[model samples]
Target chain A: MAGGGDELKLLGTFASPFVMRAKLALSFKGLSFEDVEEDLANKSQLLLESNPAEKKVPVLIHNGKPVCDSRVIVQYIDEAFSGNGAPLLPADPYERAVARFWAAYVDDKVLCHVLEAARGKTEEEKAEGLKQTLVAVETMEAAFKTCSKGKPFFGGDRVGYLDVTLGGLVVWVHAGAALYGMRLFDDAKSPFLAAWVERFGALDAAKAVLPAVERVVEFAKMRQAQAAAPATAGGN
Target chain B: MAGGGDELKLLGTFASPFVMRAKLALSFKGLSFEDVEEDLANKSQLLLESNPAEKKVPVLIHNGKPVCDSRVIVQYIDEAFSGNGAPLLPADPYERAVARFWAAYVDDKVLCHVLEAARGKTEEEKAEGLKQTLVAVETMEAAFKTCSKGKPFFGGDRVGYLDVTLGGLVVWVHAGAALYGMRLFDDAKSPFLAAWVERFGALDAAKAVLPAVERVVEFAKMRQAQAAAPATAGGN
Candidate 1:
């Protein structure tokens, strides 16, 4: 659909929330694209050729040209299919700048903290990780209140950039806490974030691309197990 | 200039290349703005309120609304003052995506490696750091050929997003190496990169924002001295 019925392909993995960003954007635009699953452990030729620098998945190819990164792909979809789909970014420059800032912040802080928290191997380390996680979540809680203004979503009744950017956080908040037996987004402390997650999770686009909650739980459980495994092993 | 003379302000410090990005964009657009130098050691109220999440400088204040992050601020300037200056990004959507991706890659890769190499405390660590630095530099060396196509700059003879983003690397390649007496960009090793630095350094905006080579050398010497100083000292 992005190529106007010409070849439009997406190379990504099944469980990557980043990949889901492109899918959600394409689906929201009602555009058809071929989806190719990637084995990240052994990247395919397409992945290598499409995004040589990172060689990571979620590369959107329109005709013969490749676009890398989920946010960039989403922006491309919004721009190429402008007037067809509801817009992802705000038309106003200032508002768009704010959205861009938040998207980058989620990448720079939220996702990293979630992964760091998940990587913790001991109670003390996990606690420190959780503290940082809450700090990031609290920042978002304030940001949501400032930007959303009591709307159902950041785009005001429509799923948009911030919602999709934070969509990955949905699984992480649930899965990360379960792995550590700790709560991250408590309703009392972060009421706005709690409500926003529910609103974002209910989106049709998100539902279509995200793996089941059980799958994420299993992923987190495996992570907890991996952390429990001893670090130093000797075969010789 | 961004808001039609509606009180544009930039909160930043002198030494920060990230802050210089905002200055470069504003000057490129020929915009008039109030420049507030922040004492980063004791961040001011305006800096704190403008960028609460990061508490970092380079917050562009158009009227009362604040935009954080140097690259995002540059994008904001381009969008807000599209008709005023030479366009900073390509008109094509796909090209825009590629520019954004590379801008991000420069942030994620080049800057970090440069910092790591500068932070090296031992000979072996410095060599390892320099190797990784060159590896990232090599990735960009390849990226330049793919994107520039024999153009003087990434934006085809104009100072553009990729140019400004990587121009920060110029100061680093000089200062970072001098701090540790190592070379990250050699003409024989990275011919395009060395030439690219020359072209970028010639830009008026680059000259305005970037510290002079002598100043950077002094800064590097100061960094070396700081690193040489003992970490723990008794305070009366």
Candidate 2:
């Protein structure tokens, strides 16, 4: 299990950045896995039973053991298969610590902030959410400048775990913002991040795991409309 | 590094529940460590340089390498020394997933809501915060009833990783609430949790690692005072 070549399965939803994190890791590791796409609205029994407490994706089943939490799944993949594919993390402990720090930071700071922003219902709420999202994006831009250090990807020349973890969110953010008619990423405001998003979009694995942007956008719009619709209408 | 008898160093502060989680793990493993207390307000150069990105504490520098994020640190400690201490996680992968899931659920749901409650600035804010806190606590109580079934600790007899994580926070929540005049844990409302709190409080490792209840209470009072102080006082 510490090496390569084992049965792997990924339980995830198409539009979830969390699920995509695991998918990108498995791909980046050059490890083949059985991808089980879950309906987030009506989650599969396997998904629910596998992760009953959280009842969320992506849950990575490796060699018959399920690892919940996207970051944890990435670490497990890196440790269990150290010899194959790109090393998800650096071999040096300090470097690994830095990577984990950023990974957790993205989850805690960036994702959480962005979700709050996206959840705003009114104009003022949306404005406040946008401000927070900008702050989060700016922080990530600074981190990437230090992390990438002018390299093409987060892992220097090649994409690695940190890149995947942070990069996977780009598609969802952009798609959701478009659906909500929100201007989240402006090239003039966040030049570095805008460019990073473009680079991430160009990745083969990213394209493979990413849902059709239009579909996600439509789904989000539909949900938002339904939520905003009057109760008497028997909203779809 | 993969076995027991490794030199373990913990960089932490006095107040952080996250830091306490790591400290409890080391103590539970019966592993002796050089505890490097960091000034989080004015973090030492080593702490700053060690985890530059986050600059937070409870970094377990095992065999001279730092591991940030309490959950990651616990898992690393558990894996690095598999057989020595009480097994931090279950042997079965699905059960392991369940353990990690709850550990995360507590962090994301309980801790997030509780921290917000603790940080409320106004009376109205405090009331809202308390409402949310009670909801999270009730949900946790129900979850714990299922999790703690036939088990002394969350690990079903022995104190496991999730237990240590939850135990560390329970100490802080109770102590902090008492000092702040916040009634977080009512005996009637959360009897099982209240009893579990006493049981966890009595653990030798918990007793050793936990600061005096008075110290934490004092810290909480000071925190509340500072938070309520005028903007000219330069407190954020």
Candidate 3:
């Protein structure tokens, strides 16, 4: 399975950051996979069959075996394709645990608040969510220091699990600033993460997979307009 | 670090199912550790320092390094003590991913609904939570067959990652029955899991650490009564 003959396919949408995480991992690992785009409004049978539990995108099918969830898929890629490229996770058990903890934080704290800010019903609630998102960013700024240890990247001079996990949102940061005048990370507030954001975005692998900021901003606007309109079938 | 000289300490509360997960992993791995019970109401400085991000329990301190979160701690225990006992996670990468997927299902689908059932503000909401929890149980029943492959456990003939993960809720299953006449798993609803509930609970390793069922029921009742009472400081 680790050989070049392995068949890897990803079922995902273009705009999903979660799906982007999977693409980023595959790109970083230097594994060429068939990118199968799914219409999220009317999901594909492959996506449904692959992940009946969540019925969500970002299902990485490696040689016909499906790995669902972005975090799980990233770890699966690192483990299954260990011989492909530089390791996404460090070898030390303790360091691996630390990476896992912060990766989970990226989704649980940062992404959760980002969604809340986007979807909150009231102005006050959205403001609070934005405030907490910044707080989460500050926390991750500290985590970037702890995990990177003053190195160029979280995996210490190479992108790793944490980088790919948070990297899913790099384009969204730019789109967010364009849409809501929000800056998730800034030079004054989260200098390390702000710098890392640019450094990470500049990488050839990341640049190849990350959606363009204008495209994401347009997509977000369309979704917002759709959400504000009357309810209809296949709203997602 | 895999030697017998490893220093392990756990900062946790008695009744936390999450903390019980770490204990179950340690006990299954045949490793001994200091169980430093925490006053969650007034959490210790050690707890605060150990887990500054969430400040929650089930923080496993191994050789003075803190590993926060039950899921992370369990994996750390397995990797750090790989030779101490039978491996908690399987050797195969795909199988490991499957185990992780279901272990997460236990928390996201099962535990989340269980908490909603216990904490929902209205009767309708609580009933909905209970309904969803049962549906999740049925989903896991099918997952057990997929992972176990007609074997005794999710790890196949022995407790593995999923077992230890869902094992945290075994006591709660019994306590729920006593408290609300609720059978989360039954002969008809989930025959395999119903039998597994009994088999897993009877293990010496499990009995050694699992809190008594009656004690949990009493604790739940006390907490419910407290919730109905007036507000006060340090209520947790």
Candidate 4:
């Protein structure tokens, strides 16, 4: 049920890589839109109404028509606002598929592992988390090598599709690793990805979309502390 | 590592909705390709080599390069052969996104629940499975009503993106329901969706891709027997 107009609105929460997908796409397209901050603890009515099935964030509402899921929203922005700034996806189908594939891999294969690793309480759980996280990171390293070649970013000159998708999560990875005193993206192992992260973070869109590293670390610390508190209380 | 020229090949199993997505896309496009059956019990080297990350089937190998994941492969087919028989995705970006969103919902929401419901052993497990499955079904009904808009299909007349996706899964659903003597798609509740299924199943693409209902039911009966036998043996 879309109201006919040119207005763009993004439903999101702060410090979420998923939400950043939609936000970055909008900034990349140079499209001005209302950003509705959602309290995930008590999800907004808009988020529930728009995405009744998933009830998740990063919903891009164009003229009251909602497009949920980050990757879907990014593609929507690229299509809807093609007349604006840099194109979010590559022109070619294969290349577009490659981008889409890697982004999906990042969500499905990588993010879950890293989040589990970050939030794991026990040493055994953390070990399992780290193992899966390494698998994801190494997989991504291979992806960067093949896709980026010797380019600075996945989109070559600019911060393209995979860059936005991974860039959003990289900050979280950094913060989550800090809380655990671990190296999630070891500089030596994934040197290319390390450099690409630096390159992507310097961009205007990333700056506009991503929360400060300190903010993420603080958030991660709070989560870590909360996770530990329950165990400590139980022990007492 | 792409070998030059356009020779299409699909690696899949007989009774997977994931594989059917690729098959249906090819069938809909009127493209001829080699269909290699994968022994998912012991995965083929080709399946592993083609899709190292996920290693799941329904890999569309064009030339020598592989496109893994049903949805991604489907989109690739649409773009690579836009001049072919039936268009899988819509011309407009918004329409394409809507299709993409709902198709993704089918994968992320509906399919898993139904599969779990089909395979559950105990009454409690089945109850949980049915609850989630119904949630998925109700959500799909809402999606069909919104996206379909009184049209014969989600893609208006012809079987479009969402049609291929849900159509691929419908056979398993029918069999799953039959095995338990339950109704997954109650005609009275989802009358529009019920009619839509009948229309979709009658299409040439559905005929080419789908195995007979009897075959699927036999497969389901075998699975149900295997599941029950394990518990029966444990109890003995």
Candidate 5:
């Protein structure tokens, strides 16, 4: 829905949670952007040309300059259109540091463990993966408990940049865990986190832009099967 | 020489580059604090209590509040004492985003490759690790070429937050590469990167606080030996 004069454009793959991150941020700000879906398997010329080094999607092109990396893109969007929506980050230095810390922690710790679990091959490997995932979840739960101050989202009452970044990954995590026949979040164990998940899920912006859960599940299943297929074929 | 009522204390270990990041920032800003060197092998009760979750060193305690993570600690220092030193981050939002991107890239790509190379058990693993390291180096070189704009340091003549964050790891990278028998930064191949390295190393602050190269080399050797010792003893 972006207009012609120096319009905003987002190049992303549908399945990427990273892409969802940018989408949610832009939408929350009520900014219009042209969503150009890139086929990751057969990457478009523009996608490659725009992001030559990484050649990965979720590239935001504004006034001909491209910004790569989801977190970077989110920050860019927040700054470029400062007046569009609520401030993505707090103004106070300590609070801003806390927000950035959690965002980076999500990338470093949570995603690392989740990816390991998603890619586990053997039963033992899968079990170990699940254990690590649980550890990550517990750590996140603790972080939230300490930092939340009774706010519904990471930023308190309303969803902010941290929530957008972390919330986008929930679908992928659930899908990956489902593929491994593991349930990572439950009310009994992580009531607050579970409530948070439900609250995020219920948001209109999230529901509108997020990829269908079924599609994510399918993609995860395909990835796991492909990984297992090669090893199983060798046995045959 | 932090005077009365200046409550800044840094808990860190000698060998950690992450800890050095906070130290360099503090030094650059000319802020004095009580430096607590932690024995990482046996963390102090205060460190354990301060950073209960990660329990890692490089915890910056300002006025009784603890800030964990080296990058976050740097930002905290920058914000808490903004008026004291050269601005750590750029005033422009876009430029700031670019800086944060590079910082995150260093942590994710560069550090990951170095750690992998350090832990590789076989020749194939080592080779793969080296290849990844080269890719990271290449990416950094490209970023520097585009973004540095002939700036001596990352922050145009003065060493800023990005430089300190990345510069802190130079000794470790050089030493770790040597320990793994890999040439990570060849002057002939990475001239710009090599020059930048020299420039960063020449900083008075860096010269003062950076652990001696020989010490880093010895540390890497010790770590590698410890990793291999158990397997060698088992073979015997």
Candidate 6:
């Protein structure tokens, strides 16, 4: 739990992997916070006011001060609550830089490509997105080899910033496999990451925060069905 | 200067704002580094190996360990040389988070839209980009007001991370006016930012790193002429 005077409140939806990053960070740190579920369709006044520019979720309010963006929020949690938990960022400056580099890679290359693969407008676009995603995954596998150096995690025997950043997508990875028959990390290609997925997902903290895979699959299905409904009606 | 034992090298192109960010950070921190100019058209092996994933410039090598990405490099410089100069990130965690939020906004919102407006595919695309750029500029103007707190700089009386992040674009802001008659910040709309451009550019450290405006304008014109040549030849 956080120090008595500190009040942490997370404004996010259940389904967002970005939101999950914040939850996982908090859980790993053992910091308790009010998990405020948001209706993105009808964004709350707090959400709008908290992040007036972007109005995106996963805004972590610490002692009434809003820290927007998951990456910023995660780092904030680590820095603000430094004494309560194992540090998310490393002590050494160079190591911290490396961790930050990979954390950025996870978002810029991996997550963005994955989203494009799943949500592209055309089959060709989706195929291109998948192709780029495979390249990103291969690059990430190499990064894992370098960073982990045979350790169980990227942080060399501990869960750190990169772990938490990528850990957010654990459920979605399963959901992607279920819906598309596409496993991002597989035994054939990215063997290290393939094993890492299982290892990371099995963590108690991760289990607590990560949404159920079946529930995510159902949500995705519902979203797809809704998207198709308009097209179907238009055709009629 | 950096500590006696510390050796710093930066790989970057002169024209790139991303590269300028790294330069600005180093300068503001009063760190002396060997500035190695990279021919982006034919990248160096060091850059390729240093950043295998992105192969982008602005890779800072400290004692031979390469840190890629401008954002990561800036933060790394601050951390690695904590004792050398004034801290780029604020000491308080909340303030650091706010600085980061604005730094990200500068990149994702302000710079990106500016690029789109300048180099969009069609007239309509350019127009839309300009419209978005105006919106982003307005938001950033407000950010400047809130962050600076009636002070001269975003760091409040000293140059900080957000200043360096946005400072990279100071030359371009001048060049844009010369080329496209588009001033992203103007007295009428974004008075703070308009004044900020002039104040940030005049600093000794900033002046040392920032490229000349006329040089940038000449380079832009040359590039534009080259682009037109291919189209002209194809038409003929």
Q: On residues B21-47, what C-alpha lDDT tens digit does candidate 1 reach at each position?
A: 678778777777898989876889989
Over A24-133, each residue of candidate 3 has an lDDT whose tens digit, in order, gives 99999988899999998799999999999889989999989999989999999999988887899999999999999999899889999989888999988888988888
Tens digits of per-residue lDDT for model 5, B1-236: 13457788899977788888888888888887788988776789999988886788899888878888998888778777788867787777677777877887787788777767657878788678768888988888888877778877777778776898888787775775566555566676777778887778877877777788789888767766776687666332
Q: Residue B139 lDDT in model 3?
A: 90
Which stretches of candidate 4 lie above 4 Å from their native place? A1-5, A119-126, A223-236, B1-5, B119-126, B223-236
Model 4, residue B212: C-alpha shift (Å): 1.6
For model 2, residues B47-66, the per-residue Cα lDDT tens digits are 87766656788778877666
Best by TM-score: 3
User: What TM-score fits each model?
Assistant: 0.91, 0.75, 0.97, 0.90, 0.89, 0.97
Q: For candidate 6, what TM-score does chain B get against the true chain B?
A: 0.95
Q: Which sequence of candidate numbers ranks them by TM-score, best first?
A: 3, 6, 1, 4, 5, 2
Model 2: lDDT of residue B143: 68
Stretches off by above 4 angstroms in model 6 are A231-236, B231-236
Off by over 4 Å in 5: A1-6, A173-182, A221-236, B1-4, B173-183, B228-236
- Give lDDT tens digits, candidate 6, residues B36-110: 999877899999998888999999999989999999999999988888779999999999999999999988898
- Per-candidate DockQ vs. reference: 0.86, 0.27, 0.90, 0.68, 0.59, 0.92
TM-score of predicted model 4?
Answer: 0.90
Q: Mark the regions of model 3 whose C-alpha exceeds 4 Å error after superposition.
A: A232-236, B232-236
Model 3, C-alpha of A130: deviation from truth (Å): 1.9
